[model samples]
Target: MRLRLRRFRPRTGPHEHRVVQPLHPLRHASLRDPDPIGHLLADHDGLNRLAGLFSFAAYSRHTVVHIPLRDGVPPDEGMGELVDLVLVHHSYGLRPSQWPGLRRRLTHGTPLTVRTDEARTARDAAAWQARAHRADRRDELRHTTHARTFFLFGSRDVFAEAADSFAYAAGNGPLHKRVQQGDLALVSAIPGLRQPPGGGHPFEVLICFKPYPPYAHFKRPGR
Candidate 1:
């Protein structure tokens, strides 16, 4: 995710509501793997090399690992081989309904990350549908308290840029103001750095980079 940081310039209407916070990854370049992951997934939250957070529910089977980018880089800072499994957060994997076609394209063993338990509940589904504007079943990935995402990247530049933009804008200052208020637009593949499309109308550009896992993501001590 690479975002060129810019303040959202209001282009229409009066009573412009400006968000005084750094909206992070919006309108940023994304680096999708450009391929689909078939059912080869074993661990739902497979680790990746970047830098971010991970959580264990204290008493649950699910653990969430966040691999956020700071800003867009030169386009090859974080490129990895296309893995057999994809950790789909927010539809990060091929859609289940569309999985058969995806299976045909890639190797078998891919699995989608249905991030939430509420994905099974109708009440949560309805509310999620009302609040989201994503692909058909993206909300299913928000099952846990953490709404992190995972996607195959095309280039490292996108990741590097996202990191740079977010780091510059997220601090408590002018940029953070608009960001916190939500009067800004974001559009980044990394989510934390997303700025809305054509968001120059009242929404400020609070560029921010989402975090990724450390370079030694799977370097759990001893192994």
Candidate 2:
């Protein structure tokens, strides 16, 4: 993706200042032979299969797929053939009956910010360590924990900017503050029992926004 520099002003601060930041263009990966999951997310038949798997807990409800942008393409400027469907499982903190209302509000689009700081990282590490001691659902926990770390820290810059932008738009309120309390999850596709016959894994990397406290299953033992 072409890196474009734009001047951005802070929306919530004592003093407004202009900063030139690079806007990263994001797009879906190719849906060709090598990437079966891409094809799965792009077609109706595949979505039906995915829905079935979700019903069986094959995937998490908080999942959101991400794909690298095509090189040299601007986000607003069309992606041409690289454009494809993305699955966003935004079932966190809501009942099945409430999904329709949320969907309607997000029909056009919404800003999603991922924020991480020293405190947030420490909390995540503590949570991971807590999960490590448990034997229940060990394999699933291990995969998700490792994948979450890899995706978040590996692309730290991108996420940082995203968080800043979100804060600017939505205000840094209590709602946004929960992100620092360990509400994010990343589940990347890996080779596992769920692999399809065509080769690639049946799922894409998922960025999940989970509920806080009692609703969230993964938490430190005492808390």
lDDT of each: 0.24, 0.27
Please list the Cα RMSD from the true structure of every candidate, rounded to 1 decimal place. 20.8, 19.5
Task: Give the alpha carbon lDDT tens digit for every residue of 50-113 in model 2.
Answer: 2222221212234323222223222221122333222223233222333233323322333333
> Once model 1 is optimally superposed onto the true structure by TM-score, how far is the C-alpha of residue 13 displaced, in angstroms?
56
**Highest-scoring model, lDDT:** 2
Clashes of 1: 84
lDDT of 1 by residue, 1-223 (tens): 1111212222122322111111233112223231221111101121111111111111111211222232333222333232211222331322334333332332222222222222222332244435456455332222111111233221122223322333223321222223223222232223222333575542121222222223333222233
Q: What residue runs in model 2 are displaced by over 4 Å at the alpha carbon? A: 1-25, 28-92, 107-115, 136-223
Point out where model 1 deviates above 4 Å: 1-152, 172-223
Clashes per model (N, Cα, C within 3 A): 84, 1
